[model samples]
Target: MRRAASMGMTTPTTPVAIDPADLAGVFDRYARDLLRYCTRRVGEQVAEDVVAETFLVAYERRDRYDASRGEVLPWLYGIATNLLRRHRRTEIRALRALAHADGGARAAEGPAQRATDRVDAERAVGRLSAVLAKLPRRQRDVLMLFAVAELEYAEIAEALQIPLGSVQSALHRARAKVRAALAEGDAR
Candidate 1:
């Protein structure tokens, strides 16, 4: 090995080919679920790019995966979370934008007061979105992983690379704030 290094000649290690089937299997198993999770954060338009980058990163770092730690979904979510950080401001803006959105496309054309139910629902969602936007990043992440991704506390911890206790506390705080915001009244 030293002689080879000194001579700038490579040792003859067998090259391993990545199977197309394995890649297909991975994408098939998790793409839809990951897409839904991504869509909820960044909207449908940007979700595809995020998921694609996630799989690309996962494939590039395949050597780092440890099956003993947990399942693939959590790992994939972990990658998604890291990638989402780059879009954090985008998410906040989207949520704020959504809050201001009419939010009741199905309602019949009329003055805003005519659709009381629609107005109420819109306000409710606006409050919720405002609350979510105000949450600390860690708390929001824990909440999203648990609420949207349907991961358990342990899985959330693994995904976010945080302690289980931290996950529990962050989620707890997030829920409390949301509940309070929703209960308080309209977003206006």
Candidate 2:
């Protein structure tokens, strides 16, 4: 007698197909956010290209996605991060420039009464840039994923395909360096 499928009966599972159309959904859902993430890391000019390349790669490798592993965003981030590594020098320079420019913009936007605050802010930016420049590439990638991308530790782990402990370690090391740099500046 044939048992009903729900009654602990074995059923043949069909393979799930990766539709090309789903790539559009990925783009629609993630493109703008990925653009912002890339822009923060690499500046506007390279950001667009990076994002475009990310989606192109994603589309090409769509079949490799395994739902059991994690979600699409982390996968996209991993791809983007790998791409960013190829442009590491450019990214570092852009970040330093952004740090300086952002600090000046913030200072300029403040009231005249806050001039002293502006000067402090600018000094902090300079120190931060120097510290970031000195940080190891892995540490910087992890730190930026945490601070700029605002990814959780687990998300960072998944995106970088590193162990969670490694993520924590990298962040701790990065923060320690930044703090040390800031302390030196304070002592000056």
Candidate 3:
């Protein structure tokens, strides 16, 4: 007697074709990062809405995507950054929120930790936030892309439409200000 063959067995899996649905999945995967970036650049309250809008805009423009350019993260970042720039007031509000929240209950630390440590960390964050606010838009963008988004310099240059050298310079300047602020706090 011959053994029964499997009815649904396949030789090998074929590469699935990419469609709008696949593109949507990509958007979903990157949405959290985009939202975080927007929240940092703008405010948490507006971040969800802004990130939704950004994905919508990206979806509309997806056909223009070039496969030769590699992954879509940099492209998404560029789009989000542009949207962030258009809403400067929202960005200011976000920074203000950071300042206000810095002094309040800590998120990661326990409630019973040393008060002095909390105060020192809060003060440092506040001073850094103030200095960050005073930076030029380009510098701030570079700093955020580097420190927060954790993108490489080339990726940041692509996202911000700046030269690699400019990315380096902006980061250097932002770092200098942050260091100076921390040092000043130390002296005091």
> Highest TM-score, which number?
1
Sorted by TM-score (best first), the order is 1, 2, 3
Which sections of candidate 2 miss by over 4 Å?
1-18, 96-114
TM-score of 1: 0.80
Worst 10 residues of 2 by lDDT: 1-10
Q: How does each model score on TM-score?
A: 0.80, 0.79, 0.78
Number of backbone collisions per candidate, in order?
0, 0, 0
The candidate, 1 or 2, that scores higher on TM-score is 1
User: lDDT by residue for model 2 over 26-89, one digit each (tens)?
Assistant: 6777788788988877888998999999999888886775543435677788899999988889
Determine the backbone clash count of candidate 3.
0
Better of 1 and 3 by lDDT: 1
lDDT of each: 0.78, 0.78, 0.72
lDDT of 3: 0.72
